[model samples]
Target: MKNSNIKNIIFDLGDVILNIDVPVASLSFAKLSGREQAEILTLFKENDLFRQFETGLLDEASFRNLIRKLVDSPDWTDEMIDTAWNSLLLDMPVERVELLKTLRSKYRLFLLSNTSSIHITQVNKILEAATGIKNLDELFDKVYLSYEMGIMKPDPEIYLQVLKEQNIKAEETLFLDDNSDNIKSAAKLGIDTILVQKPVTILEYLKDYAV
Candidate 1:
């Protein structure tokens, strides 16, 4: 049964609200690094630099430098690195933002994104061009970025911190994410969760809840 006491909503950005193409990033990196897409995938998936970058252990410059080293190209420009890294991000749907606006009247809204700095700049630019909004804070009550918080999802600490800081009851909050592990982690902490599968949208899922 859906929780009637859900007074706050915590949303995951990638794939849940934002349109992301993970394979696009692999293709971009393949072209930039002169390596096969499969190799690029394995390198990044197994590399700690990507996780470190997401959790703020690695700054933007250091992250780019690591990418440059991986590509074995001493002269890779920052733009090239950013393009490859941000290739996964597509566009934010207007409907999702509109849904957020409507839900804000009844529920406190928050954004918890496991994302990097360069991706955020691109996201803002795209969102503003489409919706005329400056950034996500205009839609959400608060935005918790993994890079800024030095914590990422599935750790349980980040979710706990958000609940404590926002003074929200775990049982009264609904968390939505595209990752199963993330959904499980939140559920374990007493927060209701939806594992948002692809082709299933936040707007569709929240219809009855928001109403």
Candidate 2:
């Protein structure tokens, strides 16, 4: 594949730009609530709470309250819940940051992620601590977060909304995501897409464009 018509690049956050381990967070929550990790993971999927939180349908306090109830731990403080919730967010590699910097010179870069406020805050802190970059805004031309937009990936409306709001053409945009469903949705709308999978980071996938 060549990049002859790719004017705008939209990148995913988790498992694409930022490293995340969902099982790690599940384990942390399990330990906190004295439940099995498998059970904790199952609970996370039972009520669509994760999706609700990512799409801004559920506020932080309400999400936390629901989590406490789900875990059967009524006494867990806000800080404790937040820590467990943020455990999945690992780090943003410096090389990936450098690649974004290099690519910014050629393409209008954008970030599109399904995320929550708590995770975004922690990710900014991690980015600042690691590379002295205050936030993701420093790396991309613009950012589109699901919680802020009240929409999420795999939904055609979100992709269409980004295109409409940015005044960018779908044919000229290339979307890279870790999730196949998101990639498929973007592709259906005439946007080019790459499914970034494990072991092959964006740096490897988009190495040609970094130049």
Candidate 3:
């Protein structure tokens, strides 16, 4: 069922490759300030914490410190913040990495993610330190991050930018994202897409391609 017409494989980096553990951070905040997860998330999100953090309106240190304060716990330590921020990191599967290495020769690979500079640094360090998958940088022809690009997924403009930059037709590009809304947005732009889900990784889903 694979479409041979697809020439470009656009990947969503987080959750697709690097696992994201949002609840860990959310729960940590809740526990630190003695609040419920729902309440903590509401205040954190309502205050535009992620947007500001991504846009560099607030630096990493300041962002963490501020969020801790909002949780009403000014006494929280740096370790607490780091632990909360990083609690969601999961191992990158070697099998998937090898699969990508094989796919590199056949199709152009690109990485698109809604990420901030701080999170990327942490992820890079964690990934390289543990797995030594050094070629991740070389495998992808382009790596686009929302914080750096000023546009995030689920936004048509970001998808437009990718097709424009690559000079490729949307139909010829297969975008893989863990976020359903992002897939829907790209689908609207005429791009082929796969909404990655639980128990199904990009590699497992694409294995039948027999490429």
For all candidates in order, the CA lDDT equals 0.90, 0.92, 0.80
Please give, for residues 95-167, the per-residue lDDT of candidate 3 as tens digits: 6677777888888889888877767777777667656855357658888878877767888999999889989
CA lDDT, candidate 2, residue 173: 95
What is the C-alpha lDDT profile of model 2 across 1-211, one tens digit per residue?
6568999999999988889997888899999989999998888899888899999999999999999989889999999999999999998899999898998999999999999999999999999988999989989989999999998889999999989988999999999999999999999999999999999889888988876
lDDT of 2 at 33: 88
Q: What is the TM-score of each candidate against the true structure?
A: 0.96, 0.96, 0.89
The digit string of per-residue lDDT tens for model 1 on 1-211 reads 4578999999999998889987898799898777899988787777886689999999999998887777688798999889887888898899888899999999999999999999899999889987999898898999999999999999999999999999999999999999999999999999999999978899888998767
Top lDDT model:
2
Sorted on lDDT, best first, the list reads 2, 1, 3
Q: After superposition, which runs of candidate 2 have C-alpha atoms over 4 Å from their true positions?
A: none
Q: Report the error of model 3 at residue 160, Å.
A: 1.1
